[model samples]
Target: MSSSFQANLDEDYIPQNILLTGGAGFIGSHVAILLAKKYPHYNIVVYDKLDYCSCLDNLDEISRLKNFKFVKGDISSPDLVSYVMAEEHIDTIMHFAAQTHVDNSFGNSFNFTQSNIMGTHVLLEAAKCHRGMRRFIHVSTDEVYGEGETFETEAMNEEHVLEPTNPYAATKAGAEFLVKSYHRSFKLPCVITRGNNVYGPHQFPEKLIPKFTNQLLRGRPVTLHGDGSNTRNFLYVEDVARAFEVILHKAKPGMILNIGGANEVSNLEVAKKLITILGKEDQMDELISFVPDRKFNDLRYTINSGKLHQLGWKEEMSWEEGLKTTVEWFTKYSGRFGNIEDALVAHPRIGFAPGSSVSNEH
Candidate 1:
C-alpha cells in the first residue's frame, strides 16, 4: 500500500467513539479488550443488555480504562439504541449483540428472532440516521452457510449460498440481509464478518472446549454426539477479535469477510485431545459417553478466508497453544460457573445447559 492510499484509508476509517454492542459476551468482550488496549485515544462504549450469558466479569480487565464505559441497554430497543448513539457521539458501531446458541434457538426461536433479527434492524435503522456514523461492522457466524458438503477440494467463500439449517443461523442470515439492504437503500457504511468456531478464555462454559474442560475437571464423562465425526474449524478468540479490527479499518462498505481457522478437526478428535491434555488418556474408556446426535446437526463446516488473509490479517495463536490456554483458564476459574444451588441463576438456559446447569453459554 502506498502512502497516499494509506492516508485515504485512514481518513475514511478513523473512529472517534465506537459503540461495541454485546461487549460483555464471549467474542464481544475479547474484541472490546483488544480495542481498548490497542487504541487509547478512541473512546470505547460497551453497550450490553446483561442477559444471563453476558457477564460483567468478562470486562474486568478493561474496567478501569478511562476511555471505557459500560452502558446497559438492549439493542432491540430503538429508543435506547438511538439515545446511546446520540449521547455517546458514536461514530463507529461494532454490532455483536445477539442470541447465538443453536440448540436454544430450536426451543425458543422467538428470543433469537427478537434479539438477532429485530435487534439488527433497529441498529441498522439507527446507523443510517446517525449523522456522524462512519461505519457499521456487523458480526456474524459461519453457521449461516449451513454445512460444508465436501472438505476435499475448495472451502466455502464469501459468495457461498446462505442456507442456514437452524433457527439461530436463520436469524443471522436475516440480519445480514437487513444490513445489505440498508447499505443498498440508504448507502449506510456497513461491513459484515462471519467467523468460524472461536475458543479462548472468558468463553461461556457451555461451549465445546470450556464445557468439556469443565467436565474433565469434575471427573465427569465427555458427551459425544452420535459417532462424533462432525468436523469444525476452530479459531482462537483473539484472532477473531483482531480480524474485526482489520475489517473495521481496511474494509470498504458492502464488503463481507469470512474469518476462519486453518486447523480443522473432528469433534471426537477434540474430545480425545482434551483427555490427553488433562493427562487422563488412561481414562478415555471410562470418561467417554456416546449420546444421541443433535437434531439437524451439520456434518462439517469449512470456509475459505483468502479475502481476510489477503487484507493482511494472520492468526497469531496456533490450535495447540489456544486450546492449552483455554483448558488452563477453565481449570483455574471453575467458579465462574457458580455453585449447584445457584446454577439456574448463573446461567439461564432455554432448553438445557450442555453439560452442567450453570452454562456461560453463548
Candidate 2:
C-alpha cells in the first residue's frame, strides 16, 4: 500500500517518513518495531541488505503494520540509496547498516570498509540531497573509542578521542567523521549515538551471550577468551531502542550522545549469569573452556550516558532480568537453531549451521 503520510499543499512542513537502514539486524529491528508502534501516523521504511547476521523474520511483527515497509537493498550503492530516499519520501534517516563483528573484520577488513565507511558516505551524500530532512541519526558503537586504561574507574563520554584498535572500530570511527563532515559542509541536520554492548531477542548467536548459551544448550563447552576478564556494559536492546526514539525527537542538531547501560559486568560473569538463569549452574565449571584471546581484545568498555539520561531516558530493565528474558527466547527457539534449514537462514555465511557438524572456533 502507498504511504498515507504525504505533504499537504497547505502545510508548512512535510509529514515525517523515516528511512531506517539495517532494520533487519538486531538493534535496528527493535528500533523499527518501536517506531512503528509509537508513531502510527509516520511512515517507517526499513532498508536492509539481509546479510548473514540479518533476518527478515526480525521484523515479522511490524511488517504488516500500515506505517511499516521493508526494502531489501544495500546502502553501499549510491543509486539504490538515492532511489530509496526519493521513493520512500524519506524525511529522516537512521543509518545503522554496518559490518560489526570485530573477529570477522580482522579477516575481511575490506568488507568493513565497504559497508561501514563507504556505505555511510554514500548514504550521507544521499541525505544531503534531500530537502527539508528533519534529522539524520547515525548509530555508532562505544568500540569507536577503543580501549582505555581507566575504564575501571572512568567512562568514555562523547568527548572521548577516537583510538580504534580494530578494523571494525576504525571503519565506524571513519563513518562518524563522515557524518560530522556532512553536517558541517552541507548543513545536513544530524546527530550521532555511541551505544554500549546491547543484548536482547533476535540477536545472531555468534556474539558472546548467544554463543555461550547455544553451547550450553548443545552440551558443548562455552569458550572463554583470555581468562574471560574482559568487561563490558550490557544494555538491553529495548532500552537502546527507546534511547533512539528519544534522541530522534529531542536531540539538537550536531549532538553526539552516548547511550549506555550502567551494568558493568565481566565476560566470565556473563557466562555464569547465563548458566544460573538456565538452571545449568551444576555444569558451570565444566561448561567454561578458556581459550586464546583475540589478537587485540580490549580489556573493558564503559561509557557515560549522562547526556542521554538528561534527556529523560534511562534503562528500565536490569542486566539480570534482560539475560533471563534472552535465555528464555533462545530456549523457545532452540529447535530452530538446531534445524539445518533454519540455521542456514539465520547464518548463511557459515559453511555449516551454528550447532551442526562444523566446529565454531570463535
Q: TM-score of the candidate numbered 1?
A: 0.92
- Candidate 2, TM-score vs. the true structure? 0.89
lDDT tens per residue, model 1, 1-362? 00011223444477889999989888889988999999999999999887766678889999999999999888878899999999999999998888876766776788788888889999999998888888898888889988887668368888888999998899899999999889888988888888898888877765677777777888888777788898888989888889888887888777888898898889889999899999999999998788777677888888888888867789899988888999988788878646522221223345653210111113
Which pairs of residues collide in model 1?
Answer: none
For residues 1-362, write the lDDT of model 2, one tens digit per residue.
Answer: 01112222242323389998888888888989998998899899988877766778888889889999998888878898899899888889987888777766666677778888888898899988877577888888898888866655588778878899998899889999999888888889888888888887877776788777777777777778788888888888888889888877777677898888888889999989888887888988897788777779888878888888877799999877899899899888755333423221212243331111110111
Error of 2 at 10 (Å): 24
Worst 10 residues of 1 by lDDT: 353-362
Task: Give lDDT for model 2.
Answer: 0.78
| Candidate 2 stretches greater than 4 Å from native | 1-15, 151-153, 335-362
Model 1 residue runs over 4 Å out of place are 1-12, 339-362
The TM-score leader among the candidates is 1
Clashing residue pairs found in predicted model 2 = none
